[model samples]
Target: MANRLTPQQQEFYRENGYLVVEGVLSREEALAYRDEMHALAERLRAQRTVNATWPSIRAKNPNVHIDHCHDVQFHSAMVSRLIVDERFTGLAEGILGPNVQLHHTKMFIKPPAKGAPFPMHQDYPYFPHEKHTMMAAIFYFDDCPIEKGCFRVIPGSHKLGPLEHQSPADHYLPEDKYRLEDALPLPGKAGDVIFFNYLTIHGSGQNESSEARTTLLVQMRDPTDCPTVQTHESRGQGMMLAGIDPNARIRPVWEKE
Candidate 1:
């Protein structure tokens, strides 16, 4: 596969802890994925899959809502193919070295006018890895402007490593120190994708616009990078996105010795 990211782009990611690439997918492809996401949301709702809106947000504003589903590829074949596509995996390899492993995939739909907001926080508290190689890629299926609560990040915050966070259950930074309004917003067009380190301090505001904000987030890490804790394990966690998993081992649960 061709190099999906240029040298300057890689350097920027290293220095800023986040990088945005435009047109990772074609406009038509993005629209198709967006439609698939909407269909999947309906199916999940029919199945009574729980709402993923943060409890904190609901507490503050009962009217706000955010719909989400984990392991999206399991629900949609198109997503399964997209995850393995060179356009996606090649970019993962460019940042995570040759052996890239998927941690999980989540589909999020922020409804118009009452979309939930995420408080500033680092992803480290959820699932920390020994090598700290875990990162996420957010693919925009529709235009995400600031008013639509596009993602925000604090540049170079990853270099601070894991900082103190609130309760593991709440998982947010101190409001007095890291306010959502202070973070740098990253507005993106359809087909754009943003990659950021897991430790990067980030969040987003509520979607105050009339249009919904749809996105697919994929968390990935080097296969050799071991998790510090066993939390956030998912069915598709160890799937290789690029190259081979050098740390593959037979589990006793699967095959008794």
Candidate 2:
């Protein structure tokens, strides 16, 4: 039960808006999650419920594909346990303090050759919170190199707060201003995780490698922080990951009996 992140790491995160921690999960653990993800994808595919491409990406290039599933814990028990695991939650606590709550979880599988690329943008447009405490931890299930479309970010971008996105419905920064080429690529090996604030401007390139890049992204926030907009609500949204929810309150009932 030691501190998962050091003072230096915390400082880097606060200053640069992101931090990459290696060996968060062991090799064996990462492999297990990767296998489970593929299995789940197969199951969802059979049911014709798996949409392997995003609409925006498709509009740009029909060949490119990036398979994804939201609320992944609801589909896999292993993932459900992973969200609350102290090793992971410890990182959340380090950033958001003791009382951490789950915002949502998502799994992304960037296929080889034709993986979709995400344009640089802030997560605030999707789900804006009052305290700006919302952050994400992306768990790499396999080695992710620059060629594999590894995550990229603009250091200190979070300090700029929420910038104007291109479209309210479809979130992205203007390509002319925030070019992907200008961002720093953060290549990571299996078991590594990258944590960044919601206001940080980030994106990734297409996976042109032979292998797929699989990752699980978990969004967390301080329980006391309230959302500015009621959006992106998930079945497991309010679940506490670490410590107690200080903002919890009993709901009032209307006497109709």
- Report the number of the highest-lDDT candidate: 1
Give the whole-model CA lDDT for all candidates, comma-separated: 0.89, 0.87
Which tens-of-lDDT digit does each residue in 66-100 have in candidate 1?
A: 88999998899999998888988888788999888
Error of 2 at 14 (Å): 0.8
Backbone clash count, each prediction separately = 0, 0
Which 10 consecutive positions of candidate 2 have the poorest summed lDDT? Answer: 248-257
- Model 1 misplacement above 4 A: 1-3, 252-257
Candidate 1, overall lDDT?
0.89
Off by over 4 Å in 2: 1-3, 52-54, 251-257
User: All candidates' TM-scores?
Assistant: 0.96, 0.94
